[model samples]
Target: MPRPPASHMPIADALRARIKASEWQVGDKLPSRAHLAAEYDVNPMTIQRAVERLIIEGLLEGRAGSGTYVRTPRERLRMVRSRHRERRGGSPFRADMAEQGRRGTWESHSQARVPAPDGIAVRLGIAPGDPTVRTDYEFLADGMPVQLSTSWEPMAITDGTPIVLPEMGPLAGMGVVERMRSIGVVIDTAVEVPRPGRATQEEANLLGISVGDLLTHIERTYYDTDGRSVETADITVPDVRWEIAYEIGIEQPEQD
Candidate 1:
């Protein structure tokens, strides 16, 4: 049986479908809520709510005293990281650094307890208020800030190690992985999360870009063999200088 539309189909769905159909192109102003209400025979408030939702989703933008207009799609920035199993084999960051002959100095390190952010807490499987060790670094490539990373480790595991020492040197070459191994925490998997957002003031200064420029933020979490979370890190990179590549495969269907 064909099911009917739900009792309350969100008005945004209709607007989104029309936009996708090219009824409205980028920079095109959408009709006012009153006009849409008259056309759809729905309440003006419903149309307003729908338009608000579209704005929040980046599909539309509202101009004060003007009207809501479609937003143009921005260029996407790419980032590269090793896959889960590949990380276990070798560190991609180390390989890239060696290939480019890049050198960096240890920026800073401190052992202070900080509450985990909502996203970090969820990824680490810890309570939001749980304490964690935070390490901040600014990596330079050819004397320019190319990578900014902040790493967090749960106090329970890292308190006994020199994980927060400033003189630890480049993690890729410094046998930090070996240290973790000595501690009996074998990393089995690493997961990377990519997020698109505007660069912060500090990031803008470091990357030599105007504040609010688009950037690709990445957060990586490493898991130990016992299924426990070992480390979580956040990295930010300028959108222009890097590209992410992926490989995909397609399986053929059975003979018809």
Candidate 2:
């Protein structure tokens, strides 16, 4: 009888090396939990834990009713925050993907006239009961899920306007700056704060990753010339999928 693999084989690391070695080619089913457990002389729960870690690492995929299989790693894309990339008319995401020779698109669902939550109210500088349009978005690059966002716009700024629905109407696909500009609101600046977070089950499902994956959470707000917040959003992207970059242009101080 073959020495049942190696009892000391670090389960997760051992499996990861096997997958990397092409022992299990992409789409090839991994060993069953029972099989792995028996071979390692460990509990099935131990095998499950190992598989879950690989899944979170995006090395393996789990299909309902089917066994786990190796997954191909995609190129890590750069999401740029720069003056030109932040322009209106075109979606920054779409433009970034195009620059990288990939196609990008997004789906958004909006609920109109919802009362602002306390936090949202503060962000938009509106009363708690103020009407707002809430939009949820999932962005895809080359047909792969890449980012998710939830945004709120106070109806006080967009009520009865052609651009109220965000993803609907004539200015539908335009960026917030352009949409607000069409209504005579000059969007002079935007702000964003990025933080680290762990992917929740719901976010994992939506982004096609595993729970506990690393995610970058961004709080983004658009302000007009008068410093009034026009729109605010919370955006999340899988850290493994994209690299975040910021570009700032420095101005010359007058030499005179």
Candidate 3:
């Protein structure tokens, strides 16, 4: 008989076990990165990465000036997706904007330009300095600025489209998918990436929050029929009120 393979686990798992065993408790500062590095016999970067994984898993929280602390045990957060496909249809930005409009809130388009940023350029498969339409909007929900989005499009394709207009009014009634279809483009796929970061001064001012507050940075890329990039957008959502859901497949072994 072959021997079983050793299990490879993340460092966060070890730290979590310590927390659960009461070696560390809520409000207790975790060991410094250097100290943890020595204890684990690993490099500082490895320790840092482990800490980051814990932060994302909500097993720990970081204070700007103080230190990292063990998070209190709380109810496990389970995100449920809508059962009906229709209810799940539409771009997230469009859905949020529509809800805001229904609540008597509105968004103001603050910036629209043609110069592409490095990140957007790479996603759109264009030169860093290539022409691209950039549109920034401040979304108000319940009469309060709650979210901000900056969307980009390849100018060669969208510059002549009516959707490039400064006002987001026309795009309001129709979602991005519908708008793209009207222009002979079909968005067949989308990819979303989420990262954690502190809100910038401008973002804080618009969202009425203090700078350095935790925020979710979301980037979405849409691909057209020919697998060509159609649009790319970056959105910032404050951590306190935003949530996302995804449908993932889980494979189970057959019963003996």
Candidate 4:
């Protein structure tokens, strides 16, 4: 048997229904917490929780020093992941944003000679404590934070090379595929596993969303033609602001 719903769930549902029915139109300020609590015959804290739920759902928004109001729904941007994107030879995130008529920019920091952790070692097929280069990126569209990425590459493959640092050297900001190619490593495939999660304090602060909001965590890795893991990354995207789309290509059969 399933457990009973939380006390706040029903309140959140009722508020959502009213918004959907147009009882509260976009940009309309909601009733005060005390007023809502009086109407629902519950504590003000209960009403606050319900409002917070709606805020996280994108049905409502809170302005500091102002009040909670119905939100104007934002059109979700589609982030396409495909092999073709990797072959484009530049910043795929920028290209993706350009396709949507938005300017894409990112702030990244790279650190070299870091020891790989146990989990990252397994993904990169290297021993724990192996030297690697790590890069952290905050991706933005139209100046709004949209995604976060942490990438790792084994130092053995790139040590002493010009592309050793991801954001510097001759191939600065060229992305993994082109940067690797500059060093004679041909990347042939990438794998991604997406999982659902809730935002933590740090992620929420950086993303400008409430803590515990919905997020999609993608574990991605790029492999060379020889099946060696060359790069691995963990990417985080907020669900309310973006939708992830995947495009697949079919291979042709050998001609007789």
Candidate 5:
């Protein structure tokens, strides 16, 4: 079997076995890398690799200014993407959090008159370099960062309107559907496409996870009654911490 790989695999397996045998309880700090290296008769780099593997597997977590510890398993939160939520009048994220007994809060910044890039332009069905209002958001649940999103709306739709700022003005934080409704846009549909990806360095830093961790990237767009794309957004969620759930409502046939 090609010499069974190398030293790190066996070292990682040994550590995993110890963890499985209750040798380290949740929140218990692991021994120093040097100590583990000496005990395993391997280089410190080898032990580091082993620990990193465990961390990626969610069995351990690294703390800054502290050491690695057995991680406390967390319940995966469900982020519901439902047509019903789209029809709701207020913040869908806040409602979702309320359903799970957690407070949902977000901080956002908006920049007006940003030129739309090709990708965003395609989603919004507008010409590239068209003016837009762009808003970036960091959403938290129970005061912990759980999601990130960036949304764009064409300036042609809401150039001088109160809802143009997204997170400011009178209709602040009411969500796309409600905000557009206030302007008589009447958003009729929303579409979302979810893709799995590796977390980038910035994403890792914000979510407090290792770089390259699993994440779900969702591209969502809302269309008005006339099928004009009114707003588009890219949403990011950590895979280890949340699961995306879609709630579909069945349409009833006409009753004679």
Candidate 6:
């Protein structure tokens, strides 16, 4: 006898509840689709869909030629970025890790005289093909890779200066704002735009995650009070393992 269609969402919810309640303990294989379909009086396709949703949600994991089993999620690292911390002119990653009694380290690679593309040139207020310093950074906390950043700064401003190369100067690791301040450039503002992205092969390789995993892409630009862009960066953080927090001061409008 054919059974009426059932919503897979409710089935997924029910399975998730059981998993959370430990009824289906970690490493326990979930029942087969045939059995679930018979028990719920639903189509086999519905059962399959419900299981797939649970797999994607990290409540269950499917093995090749084996049944799906409950999953034990890894511990996540939480990071906080705030204007108050920025005033201290330290690595935000290091500060956040220190709060949790963890250590953070990062390595950077730089190239000078790299030609800026059209988009970068516009943000930098320089002509297309203008030379700039480009640097790539990989940050790890507790020896686990957590973040990646690629930044560009126009050479016209830093040419013949001691900090032209980001990681090679006496001011190495001091941060862009501080380094620029040393060179008489006072950074007044920064803007960030965060968007959801899928991990690429390189990102997956560095972060040790599967390709196509969800990630957060943040485009950040620093500008001087004169409205000139001083630096720009593309920052990447994996969603499955990190929770990014931000703090800002909101001022209320003056009452009439």
**For residue 158, what is the lDDT in candidate 4?**
99
For candidate 2, give the lDDT: 0.88
Q: What local lDDT score does residue 177 receive in model 1, on the 0 to 100 scale?
A: 52
Q: Which candidate leads in TM-score? A: 4
Q: lDDT of each prediction vs. the true structure?
A: 0.68, 0.88, 0.69, 0.92, 0.90, 0.85
Query: Can you write out model 2's per-residue Cα lDDT over 1-256, one digit (the tens) per residue?
Result: 4433333338999999988888998889998998988887877777888888888788888999998989888567678878777663567778888888989899999999999999999999999989999999999888889899999999988999899999999988777888888999998888999999999999989997779998999999999989999999999999988889989889999998
Best-fitting candidate, measured by lDDT? Answer: 4
Which residue runs does candidate 1 get wrong by more than 4 Å? 1-79, 83-94, 104-106, 162-176, 246-256
What are the per-residue Cα lDDT tens digits for candidate 3 across 181-235? 7679888777778888887888888886656667878897888889998889887
User: What would the per-residue lDDT of candidate 6 be over residues 211-243, giving only the tens digit for each residue?
Assistant: 666798988899987999999999999987887
Cα-based TM-score, every candidate: 0.57, 0.81, 0.58, 0.92, 0.86, 0.81
Indicate the residue-level lDDT of 11 in model 1.
Answer: 84
Ranking by lDDT: 4, 5, 2, 6, 3, 1
lDDT (C-alpha) at residue 251 in model 1: 68
User: What's the CA error at residue 19 for candidate 6, in Å?
Assistant: 1.9
Model 6: weakest 10-residue lDDT segment is 84-93
Tens-place lDDT per residue, model 5, 101-183, is: 99989999999999999999999999999999999999999999999999999999998889889998898999989988898
What ranges in model 2 sit over 4 Å off?
Answer: 1-10, 21-44, 63-67
TM-score of 6: 0.81
Please report how far candidate 1 places residue 76 from its true position, in Å: 13
For every candidate, C-alpha RMSD to the true structure in Å: 9.9, 4.3, 10.3, 3.3, 3.3, 3.8
